[model samples]
Target chain A: VARPRIEQAQQHLDSLTKPPGSLGRLEEVAARIAAMHPEGKPQIRKRGVFLFAADHGVVVEQVSAYPQEVTAQMVLNFLQGGAAINVLARHAGAEVTVIDMGVNHNFDRQLPLLHKKITKGTGNLRRGPAMTREQAEAALTVGVELATQAQRDGIDLIGTGDMGIGNTTASAAILSVLSGHAPEAITGHGTGIDAATRRHKVAVIEDALRLHQLDPTDPIDVLAKVGGFEIAGIAGLILGAAAQALPVVIDGVVSIAAATVAYQLKPDVVDYLFASHNSTEPACRAGFQILGQEPLLDLQMRLGEGTGAILAMNLIEAAVKIYSEMATFDTAGVSRKQLP
Target chain B: VARPRIEQAQQHLDSLTKPPGSLGRLEEVAARIAAMHPEGKPQIRKRGVFLFAADHGVVVEQVSAYPQEVTAQMVLNFLQGGAAINVLARHAGAEVTVIDMGVNHNFDRQLPLLHKKITKGTGNLRRGPAMTREQAEAALTVGVELATQAQRDGIDLIGTGDMGIGNTTASAAILSVLSGHAPEAITGHGTGIDAATRRHKVAVIEDALRLHQLDPTDPIDVLAKVGGFEIAGIAGLILGAAAQALPVVIDGVVSIAAATVAYQLKPDVVDYLFASHNSTEPACRAGFQILGQEPLLDLQMRLGEGTGAILAMNLIEAAVKIYSEMATFDTAGVSRKQLP
Candidate 1:
């Protein structure tokens, strides 16, 4: 039933009276939604962005130069609307909610913070599993709850973004497991790390994989063993969004890894996923390919503060508007013939 | 006097609260404006984007696969808000007005059109000068008038974009003479032309330069010989924007060439100019250096429909809002230093 509805949406999009495939990946998203609700018009009236923040215990391994404190600092930056994500979100006309899935610091209760701590950050993933299976489930449950609540508040399009120090290493590990690639092929310099540090980070990821004896077949199991709480939460957000037939715009590599895990859990979930942009990170391209999605923007961006997702949000609005507006060529009374 | 204003603006931007010199080229424009009006705050409240559309007579030389009619077709596309520039401008919150500077077609009277034809698009430059000095001046005057009207409408920013087929060949020719480089160095595969067609385009430009005996030192002489009517007009627009103390965001290689000519005319005009992005065109980077301006974005974009400028417009708004709306440390009562 879901497959036919998805096909119906795509057929309606193909008939929308513009140059076929001119809108790029946006056309794919519009079609996917059209298929989701074949009986009604596809609409994105209310949009919500979920910013999941956590601390990565891999920072303890000196993989990143920035202190774990920067994660909390950036979370404050987001709350105060001082980050690039804030500016882009305001421009995209989307409401943003920051969730403290698992941060090391004690946050103020009045800051609209959602307390969904799986653990006081993950255990040092360089040594063993970042979080237990039970902890991963708890974080995923938190994400599910957040998405359900957003849907109740009338959100039809949900975007996933994340904030954490040294999390890119975790994302690379997850990508390797999901894409069946080696660590060297996916690991990259995150947050201005030098070449030597990058090599060390890759080694740490490879070491952790061997220690945990992580399986490539089960993505959630791999994530539970090596991913940050925020990454697991975002994966759950992707699932929750798809379960409700809402679209999820995945951000950079970390969010991409999350979406990959969610898709592994439910292949049908990809019917509701749209990749926002290609990150400079090599892992991002592999992740996008694994999910069979093409990113809309390629600005060589690697700053994973949801900047790519925010930039791609405007195009989604344009796509949906084209679906809803723009009279057909028959109505516009313009000839389709090539000019003489 | 303009020199002092530019220096003052640069110094003021340097003094702003943030990482010093971290904002890159954006800080340069803010500083130039500070120098322009030492006592007044720099403001970019109202913006006008001029999209100059024309067809190159050189296209008749078999230098391009698409006929000249595609120029007019794209112009119509711009007016209908179907082009990439239209989408980006809508996101940037700028009003776009298309000028039919020299297209060889009669637009319907009912359609929105600005007729400033210069000899129905200049005679093929491969034979001689693309246009007469008088015709070039007339086209430039049209641009001046447009800028004056934008000023009257309370515009504080002016941007230049163009839609002319085969203009890259002309731009490469002009850039070669202006930058004292050979044509081959500046020329690129414009509009995805085949390798064979590109060689022909390069040869055409070289022959045109030799036939005209264009002097590299004289900017106006070089422009009259190889520049498009729209290119000259854009150069005039940059001067007009600078004359009014408004920032002018330049689009791609063509717009950068205009900025170069404008700077040559009045070095202080560089104060009001901002390079929107570093184009993939080799000539554009040289033009930026020649004008002593840096681009806000470096996306390797070569699309000359003002898309780059539109992308940067949002960043400008963000920078200004930060400058105007962010509370000072004293006012916000937030500690600037780390807590003891």
Candidate 2:
């Protein structure tokens, strides 16, 4: 039902005054929304970027080269508008909100912290499940609450990104379980880890799968057992965005893993998920292919501080504008060129 | 001399209030400019993007699947705000001026076209020289005039981009001749050409090299014989921008080839050039390495039409803001953290 409508909108938009397919992926997105609500224009006035920050217990395994403290430092950097994501978001005119999902540090309650700590961080997944079923649910609930608040604020477009050191290992574990791929196939040398460290990271994910008796076919169970708090929260955000009819620009491999979980939980949620870019991670291409989503950008970028999503914000805006403003050929008094 | 000044500026900027080397290449750019001026803060204002359009005679060899007619069609696309470069330049708030360096069509004399056509197009480079030395000089002179006008209009920053369907082939030929690399090493499948077509394109360039008796060491001679008019114009634009002390964001392979020629002609002119992105073109890396410049971005982008340069405009703004803003640590009354 959703696919037909989106496709119809795309067809309508393509037939507008400009050259067919000249707007590139922007045309695709605009058409998708037109299909979503065939009777009215799809507006993206209140855009919100939800940045979920947490601590990956895999940092305890010494897999990441950077100290775990860099995660908190980067959060402060984001607040101060010094990070690349901040610069990109500012350029796109997107409102960014940071969530301290389960970071180890404590901040003043009045400092706008969401305060949804899920066990202060997951235990190192090399030994066991990152979070129990109850904690994962709590994290998802937090995501739901965030999305609900965004909807109340009239946010029509929701983009999900994350900041968690060593979370790539968590993403690989979740992806392996969700996509039915082996750990080695989905795992990558995240954040410039050496080959030995990457191999060790893969082994840790494998150990976690065996310890949890994870079922690759069941995404929710996989997320509950192996997903980081931020990953679960992003999944919730995707589901919530879909429930509210808001589009979600899922960023990179980690976000795709979250989207997979969200789609598994609610199959219709795929309508709201727009994969932002084909990340450098090999698993990301497979993930998008399985989900039947095409990314707007194909830069070999793997720096997952929501950089790719922020860049895609401009493309999304262009799509919405074309949908709203582009006059049809008849209205613009332009004749279509006859096909040769 | 430019290299040392840029290095000095980078060092001074690294000592600013924020974390050392945290702002990445933006800081480096600002610092480079600061070192060049020494007395006053480096400023970037009144930015202009010169979109040089031409038709390559090499298109006669079927080097590009897109017909030569697409060149003029895209020029109209640029004027009508339907091209990717137009959208991106609009987003960056930079003014664009289109120049018909050597289009195969004639227009009203009263139109704003710069009558710089060396020929209807280059001579089919597969057979002989693309342009005579006199024609190449005339094209370069046109670029110089355009830059001079931009400077008079108070533009402190200029960017070079090109629009010609078969220009990538020309860029590859120029780069191979200048860098002494085999054509196959520098040539790529431009605009989705098939492997067989790509090989043919490379062989055509190799044939051109043999027919012209081109010396790999003489860059200007190579460019004069094998480069498109737009490339010659861009070489002049780089030199013109340097003469005025204005920074120019050099686009991908074609623009880099132009800059290489300009540098060979006037070694000191390299001061004004900044590599926008290391394009997916294999020759681009060698070009940048030869110029001793690092690109601001490396997203594997091969789409010319100034998309990469426009994308980098935001980073330049960030760098300039950091150079001009951001209270020093002493002024902010914040103690600097001791290095670990």
- Per-residue lDDT of candidate 1, residues A17-90 (tens digit): 33344344556666666666566766678777899999988888888756787777777777787655675577
Candidate 2 DockQ category?
Answer: incorrect
Instruction: Note each model's CA RMSD in angstroms.
Output: 5.5, 5.4
lDDT of each: 0.75, 0.76
* DockQ of each model vs. true complex: 0.13, 0.12
Best by TM-score: 1
Pairs clashing within candidate 2: A5-A35, A9-A31, A10-A31, B9-B31
DockQ of 2: 0.12
Residues B1-340 of candidate 2 have per-residue lDDT tens digits of 3577767767666555444554445566777667657667776676788988888888878877567776776666666665667666766788888888988877557655556666777878887788888889888998888888888999877888888878999999888877888898999866557788888998998898888888766766788789989999999898888887778899899899898888888888877678888777788977987798988765556667776777666566656766765545454443343222
lDDT of 2 by residue, A1-340 (tens): 3677867777776566444554455667777766666668877686778999999887887777567776676666667766556656765678889898888777567765566777677778877777788888889888988888898998878888888887888888887877778889888866667688888878888888888888766776788677889999999998887887778898988899888888878888887778888776777866786688988766556767676777666667656766776556555444453321
Candidate 1 lands at a TM-score of 0.78
